[model samples]
Target: MTLLAGGTDLMVDLNFGRKRPERVVAIDRVPELSHLEGNGHVRMGAGVTYTRMLAEDVGSAALREAARTVGSPQIRNAGTLGGNIATSSPAGDTLPVLAALDAVVVLRSKQGERRVPFAQFMTGPKKNVRRADELVVGAEWDDAGPAQTFMKVGTRNAMVIAIAGLALVVDRPRRRVGVGLGSCGPTILRAPQAEAFAAAIFEAHGWDRHLTPSDAELKEFGRLVATAARPIDDVRGTAAYRRHVLAVMGERALARVWSIT
Candidate 1:
């Protein structure tokens, strides 16, 4: 049996005869999966559509920006965040944002509830650890703040698969930084070395101060981010090109988040 929410990815599979599930359960209208709430932290239901995310400012700035680039208006209206999580596509626009935020996936089963870190949720391309009996109800994360952004390089300006995407977040309170990479790996990847390098700079410069990293530092950070990618040569782009795109996007995303000229 298969579950259906937005039907954006699943419908494509069905239409193309890629997936012929013996049973398909529609859960788009389940009230429990449509809530969006936030205080110091945010909890967005799996059924929350990209359109809703953009209108309501559901997650972070990066998330809102990613939502804005998802697809056509109609696709945004139907494509749900939970559906994106369920599909676990490497190129899913919001995946990198979620990774940068360190969001927690909330899965519910008849037995009880389970929460999994976003890092551990996706095991491979289009695969996750969700059990057959589990339903991905929502995702939750602490507010990162305004110093964050998401950017992607695609074939065209709109409605195109990303060649590479990057999400960068700076947590002032924690004096830490995060970089999430997409469309350059089998699964969304966090750039640990790049994050550590940025955090070190933030520590030295003072988190509250506006400090511009040297060109060499910025370039090295980009290189570290590029090194984390596990890409393959595909129709969208080549592995080398993806790495280059990731490096550029990573550097620009960090610079943008820092408000650097």
Candidate 2:
């Protein structure tokens, strides 16, 4: 039983930790866990590189867009979505996208396999997981929704830690707003209040399907999103700034979803 992904978080921890495990194994080379298969319901290999994700014709707006934002081409070439989930960093590029897409994680062990929703798999920052013996063979998602958009605020445009990042998936019939906050709390946050807030706004305005927000509605929505954040001021930015950025980004996400549709 060992942790295997891109080895990013594990390698880092092992270097810093005094107690090193005596036994170790790497399954990154497992061919079965490295291919993207299944179309009706998407199944992503645990070792599927971000480079593969970006290059694939697999047209998931959420995954496609996220693949582009992941690290440098080199990092993307090395990092895996399974690694992102395994790391459980709130700032993980793929996480907000997965959470918004309402994706599922597949965990496997010698015993068998179990699937957990993305949100449930992510209990807290740098956490949420499977047993020591379990391997994250892949992830699965269903496309019963609208196109999506991903947003994040880092010091620079790319290759930066997200102060706050959000993903919005709008399937008019199942209209939903999924928000993920990084570096704001121990775990990525889901803004239930903000979701309802946006839903009300959408409901009141009628299902235009092309939902547009007035400045008032935008501000109100932002405030609700702001409340969902549990940001702390650090070297990167301030809590107030995180709240404000998340709000602005969220509005942009909303606009993008509409435009895409």
Candidate 3:
């Protein structure tokens, strides 16, 4: 049975004659998968749309920012996070935020329910770990707090696919840092080394809620973020250009999140 939520991706392909399905199971109306719950780890139902995220406090600064980078108002209203996760596109704006937030993908089937880490859920571009009978119920992750940011570099300012993207999350109280890269990798990736470096910087700064790293530190962090990516040349951008832009974005995101000029 084909699972359908919001039908944004499915409809796009169907309308363009890119896909033809004999049958589909509409999951968007499933009440269990249509609500948001939990506080520490916000659990968003698969059917939740970008418009709803922006309209309400979806709980993560990075996620809300990423949601804003999605398609226009109409698309945002119709496109669901479950669709984006299930579609597994490299340019899916919300995936990077999920990665940085260390999200858990919740899957359900006739057999039972299972949870997969966001990193392990997506195998490659348009590929994921969900079984044929499994349905994506939702995603869960801890709040990214106020210091998180999501930035996408695209050919156009709006309604454009990202050439490169970055998501950064800083938890001052926990002195933790998270980084996710998008559009420049086969699947969204976290820069462990870069995260570690940033965490150390946060500690050195006394976990200052407003601490901003020095220029040299930011540069090194950006370099590490670039090094973590395994990008390729594509029509949207060249591998070299992606690396360069990601480096700059990493620095800029850090500066923005930390309130640095």
Candidate 4:
């Protein structure tokens, strides 16, 4: 049996004969999965659509930007965040943002409900730890402040698949920086070295003040982020090109988050 929400991803699989499930459950109307709530830690229901994500205050700038870039307007209207998480695609625009924000995946089953950190949620491309009996209820994350942005490079300007994507978040209150890479790995990956380096710079310069790193520092941070990717040569692009895109995007995203010119 398969669970269906907006059917944005599942429909394509079905249309292409990639998925032939004996049973399909439609959960779009489930009240528990349609609500978006909380403040300190924003919780968005699985059934929440990308259109809603853009219109509502989800407490993550990166998430909003990611949502804005998903497919076309029609796709955004029908595509759900839970669907994106369930698909577990490395290029799912919101995945990198979720990773950067350290979001929690909320799941429910007959046994009970459990929350899994985003880092441990996805095992690989289109694979996750979700059990057959469980349903993805939503995702939750702390408010990382306004200093965040999402960037991606695609073959075209709009409605295109990302060759490489990056989401950068600056948690001023925690004095932490997070960088998440997408489409450049088997799964959404965080750049630990780049994060630590940026955090240290933030600490030294004072989080309360607007600070810009030197050109060398930014380049090094980008290099560290590119090093974290494990991309493979595919129809969309070459592994080398993906790494280069990541490096460039990582730098630009960080600069945008810091409001650097």
Candidate 5:
């Protein structure tokens, strides 16, 4: 059965004649799918809507920030994080955030439950590892208290898909850095080199909350992020444009997070 939650993705496909499913199962009312819990490590029900994410602390500031950029208010009220994960759109706003956070995706089926790292969950654009009989129950991650931010280059200020996007997470306590790329590759990608570069800077700066990275360091970090991206020209943007934007966004996001106390 085709799983249905917020119907934000599925309904669009239906309306556009892109999908014609013979049957669908509405999983939105499943109690287990609607709860959001935890602190040290957070669990967010797969059915959690973007509206709920913004309404409540969803464990990560990066997630909350990404949730706000999903779509218009009405769409946010209806779109579920599970749906986004399952849909596996390269442009899905929250996927990069989840990847950057290194979240775990909880998949359940009659066979049993299995946990997969977010990085391994999606194989390519609009493709994932979920079996036909399995359902996405929720996702979880250890809380990395960091100054985090999400930014995307869309055609408009709102209600638009990303041309190229990036999620920057600075876990000062752990002396770690994460960079998640969106709409710039076949799947959501993490910039390991950039992350390592930034983390080294954090280490050098003693992970100081008040520390501001030098302009040269930030530029180098951005360059690394851009280099990590494997983008293709699409209707939304050219590959070269995406690379340039990713670089700029990487530096911009890092700057914003660093400015936070």
Candidate 6:
């Protein structure tokens, strides 16, 4: 079976001695695995690169924006969505976007093929998974509501890792909240409380009339996002600071979605 996806993690791991697999099958140049096709449920080849993600007009704006934040034009050109999941990085820029969209991954082996949800695919930090003989071919996207955006806090921009990152997908239809933290904890996560809270808050404020949410409500929603984070104090930042960033990011995300000052 082929182990393909941007090769960012696999190549690095092999080089750094973090991991070494005896038998390696590359799918980087496979035409069938490099195309992004399908509708209603967007089916992407596991080999589709980040550059493809940034350029796609079909997917949500949030995903495109998040793709823009990935390593660089070079990295985006090389990285694949399947690679992001294979790396099992909680801070993968596209990961939270996938989670917020409730994406499904297609895994195949000599035995057969199975579809797994993004949430279930990510078992933990730097984990979840494929056996020695299994292949992760591609992933499919679902619809996320309107006015979605992605934000991340790092030492700098361009190619820096996320100290804490968030993707807010807002809509009256499929309201979802995906928060991805880098160097914060084990895995990327969906903020259920924050999602539910934001939905209720938005419902209370009314999505149809465009009523403004009060500062208190906004701050509370921010707190919920913060509460959902599991950041840690590392060389780059502190847990408290990470929490603060989550709140500020969440607030700004909400504001940006609404185009409020």
lDDT of each: 0.90, 0.75, 0.88, 0.90, 0.89, 0.75
TM values, all candidates: 0.96, 0.88, 0.95, 0.97, 0.97, 0.90
Q: Write the per-residue lDDT of candidate 6 for residues 1-261, one digit (tens) a residue.
A: 337456777888878988767767777888887777655557877787878877755466777888888898888889987788677787788788777777888888889998888878877877886665667788887655557888888898889888888888775454344444344567777778888877776666665445566788678878888888888887878999999999998888877775421
Candidate 5 has which clashing residue pairs, if any? Answer: none
Residue 255 error, candidate 6, Å: 1.0
lDDT tens readout by residue for model 3, 1-261: 577777878988989998888888787677777788757769999988998888557888888888998989988988898999999999999999999988999999899999999989999999999998888889998765678899999999999999999999987756688899999889998999999998887777666656756899889989999999999998999999999999999998888887521
Which prediction has more favorable lDDT, 1 or 5? 1
| Candidate 2 C-alpha lDDT tens digits along 191-240 | 88877877776677664455556777767767777788888888888998
Summed backbone clashes in each candidate are 0, 2, 0, 0, 0, 0
Model 3, position 199, has a per-residue lDDT of 85
Q: Write the per-residue lDDT of candidate 4 for residues 149-200, one digit (tens) a residue.
A: 9998999878988999999999897778888889988899999999998888
Candidate 2 local lDDT, residue 38:
51
**What is the lDDT for 48 in model 2?**
86
lDDT for position 170 in model 3: 87
Off by over 4 Å in 4: none
Candidate 1 colliding pairs? none
Model 2 has an lDDT value of 0.75
Q: Which window of 10 residues has the lowest lDDT sum in candidate 5?
A: 204-213
Model 2 misplacement above 4 A: 15-19, 38-40, 144-146, 201-208
